[model samples]
Target chain A: MSATCHPSDELLVAYGAGSLDEAASLLVATHLALCPRCRAEVGRIEAMGGAVIETLPPSDLGADALASVLARLDQLPGAPMPRSPVVAAPGLPSPLRDYLPASLEALPWKRLAAGIEQAILLQARGIRARLLRIGAGIVVPEHGHGGMELTMVLQGGFTDSGTGYARGDVAMADQQVVHSPAADGGETCLCLAVTHGPLKLTGLVGRLVNPFLDL
Target chain B: MPDKRLAVEPGPGAERFSDLLSAVAQYGDRQAFALLFQYYAPRLKTYMRKLGAEDAVAEELAQEAMLAVWRKAASFDPGRANAGTWIFAIARNLRIDMLRKEKRPEIDFDDPELVPDPAPRADEVMATQQSESRVRAAMSGLSAEQTEVVTLSFYEDTPHAEIAARLKIPLGTVKSRLRLAMKRIRSELGDDQP
Candidate 1:
């Protein structure tokens, strides 16, 4: 099914403008793989970039830039060979395939709590992207975000404050939102999450577990 | 719609570029490729420069972007995107690859699991003919504050938080401006079809 929840227009604009950092871009790209609506939105945004480029006063290239490009053009094949299609792990999106193991069961999952496990896929420039697997019917500790956090469900589903997010649904949280999310019963819920800053777990349980978890 | 049409005349120049790219794709026309290089290379250099590349690196990347255009010309679909939009995407992707150490994960069109958009309407197909001009018209309609944010966000590598700091505005304001700007642009493009 097509994704019902999407990243905000602001995020999609950043993705189209090439301004989003690598980890965030990976998350948004994976969502775009399942979302045609956002893809169309990004197409319009890129067209705006083209329009802006057309209006910019030209800057002079090196004197022989055109000649240099022409020289190299001759060496290229008349037409580029069609790229071989990428083979993603079953049930995994293509964008995530490279960063993950062949299957979810093989991931180097580190336990964060009795019912929670995570595998960090990438971290850079204060941003982190990871995979979270929550045991069925488990309620994650209530937490507030330090900055923007984006979570997209890859398998099963979760409910936050009475709202359900199924596969391909994105849940965005920031400093203002604090809630405990519970994975639905009958299946382990797997999610790909990208965060810009640290997450602050609240309450006594959170306080006890917070220091031990490196999230 | 009439006012938008008046604001920006249909870009004959844009259509011409599309033809030139098609010629390169169909027959590997060197002269056509040269014309494209002449128009886009310097602008692309400016794009790289605005993104913080020094002059030499910018020049090199611009050349690389143009070379990519030639190699990938066969993949260019004039029915879906005009030449400027197509080249912009190429240059944007090249900049990401060369400037950033991290990989930019992209959707593979040929992936078996890929979901496709619903079929387009006839009007939507016709809309591609003047998409660049329509975008220009849409851009002109944005407020100055919205335009400033959009321009910086597109031309610079600055993130939203950095843009907020640079402009001395709150991060929330920056996001709102972008959201409003995109809403205006979308409405102007008549892209609100369900």
Candidate 2:
């Protein structure tokens, strides 16, 4: 029940390992920003990481390495610099102004379903990303990954295969699974999706769009 | 037998504190910068090594992560996150940069090189292993459920309700187990707690 909204242990472990991608990383970052107990647990894992470092026999460091770093450090004159308030604290994310590439935020969103709209974010090097916003209660077409698909919930909640996902939950799918996803009727569901291949659409319309989507 | 994408992490988490430190270092804080540098160097080294960096490359990246710390200390915020997590994130980002260069095959989960890391040292892991042995020796002192609860909490960092669900026990039962386990570990570690 709670798990429908929570990330599993493996996901957290992947996050700790730094194996997650940027889009999903954003989702998790947003989640970790708000959850305190999880924060402490992550801190403990970090402490464990430190303890691991302690057990390793000291490997020899390069002669010039320490000196080089010290030199670079010395070159940095101590000065108070301009800071972003959001960057400094856990409040609102930085206004979408600073980071979003203009092309990404400015895309024309197309209605894909009732209360659901999607805009392609960017495509390069055989990877395509899209920003999808689903109003509460909107249900997306049932689909599965063609190769591999990584989905991160940025805001609101989405129910896929009857499982609900809120902000920070990452849903991963490969060719082996097929399921339809819907959002809860409570909030707007925002997600960043990264797809390397294509998505297999389960419905009739999906069959038509599938050809175009195959890139 | 493998899906094409290299996506492994299927959940949420991030490093706001480190982002701040990077921003702050961009500003200027001498004292804060030094403190940041001192903390992350070893981790950066460890991370670089995991990325298949020779010792030289690993050492350089370690210095780079710390240098960023020195330059960006002014931006460090006590509120967002402490120095350690912030720096750890910085080092991790640096590790990612090195890893992308390895061009390692995507599906080979066995690539020790691709083990995404918070940049922990192998020695440090060995210490935890030793502590695990000590903890095991100490565990005989508690009931079976107490051992399970302590392991899940300390190792998994699971939520109370979740732990209950995981163990197929009542929430209250899980709490009791935790309480007993803590009492035992405390008495065992007594002065070691300091």
Candidate 3:
């Protein structure tokens, strides 16, 4: 972030409030992972959300809400889908990874770079999310997004433009602009990326590979 | 207006999110997982709304997040962080993913001149603004530039990035100002402890 950033207090608020889209969510998380300053700001806003909740007037439940929940319990064991293998991060901005059906931390990850590796944990809706590892001094190509791409840095450091990112950071791209990310040396940059569509390569080779990468 | 969106009494089975997460992980019970979903879904919806996402989009994200919870139920560990903190981290990361990177400028990390002073300021305006009125007043204390970052982050629902493009101040500044404001507020609150 060069004096400015994509996530602001309001966005953090909305993020705390759950108004952001899935595509954008990844980007902010990537940024937050690296920038501790934003992380603190987000924490404050979340507190404000609690304050707002406290200030709100109370309303009664639907009488059978508890019973309904309890009744629904029995059917849960037979849920239509298999237990989804969600990756559980150790820190902030966590999502459904809370109920992951398996131990993702133990999975075998393939190296993409020195510190960058990826474990393709799950895929659905033409979107595939995998864990990425980026070691220090590593620079990814400066490229634009395709349709939607979600990335979360689990460890180490990476920076794009003027903003530096660290563990727990997430970034989302949506064919809006181009960026080249490089990891801070000596630190391992572990990330989780979800590609909603094929990636559109930039630069000359990007153009040539665009046909073959099929991403 | 915020109140209108939430359910009262938090419905039923009001247990801490951490509790439910622990139960599922240690016990391998699906019911524990269900309790966690019922506990968080509506609040998660409200959170999505605050992010300025459409209800459907928010709902979908929330569902996806929840589904992840279903799948990841076995890994909940209570020692590292509480359940709310952990889930919040996940949801927060998920939201961060949605923001797109605009035109990324080349960064010269070698030049110390380019980086904002990394010093953490303790007495920024946001800290002084403890009450609602104080908060509004504190906004006046910031330069219009700082105020914009604050407003966009706290109100506009735009991610930190769009704020950079809209203001052209650079993403680092946006993060720094926010950090300063939050630090100030924490100090202000801390001063009252005695």
Q: lDDT scores for all predictions?
A: 0.82, 0.51, 0.51
lDDT of 2: 0.51
* Residue-level lDDT tens digits of model 2 in A65-100: 556665666566656643333332122233221234
Cα shift from native, residue B147, model 3 (Å): 14
Interface RMSD of the predictions, in order shown?
2.0, 13.4, 10.3
Model 1 stretches with alpha carbons more than 4 Å out = A77-87, B1-12, B120-130
TM-score of chain B of 2: 0.36
Query: How high is the TM-score of chain A in each model?
Result: 0.92, 0.70, 0.54
Best by lDDT: 1
Candidate 1 lDDT for residue B31: 78
Ranking by DockQ: 1, 2, 3
**lDDT (tens digit, per residue) of candidate 1 on A8-70:** 988888888888888888888888878877877887888888877777767898888888788
lDDT of 2 at A25: 43
Worst 10 residues of 3 chain A by lDDT: A92-101
The alpha-carbon deviation from the true structure for residue B33 of candidate 3, after best TM-score superposition, in angstroms, is 23
lDDT per residue as tens, model 2, B45-148: 76567546778777877777777666546544444334454455556555656644311111111222121223333543423322423433455577877756
Q: Write the per-residue lDDT of candidate 3 for residues B14-98, one digit (tens) a residue.
A: 3245556665666655555655666665555566566676766766666556655655555544442345544554554455555
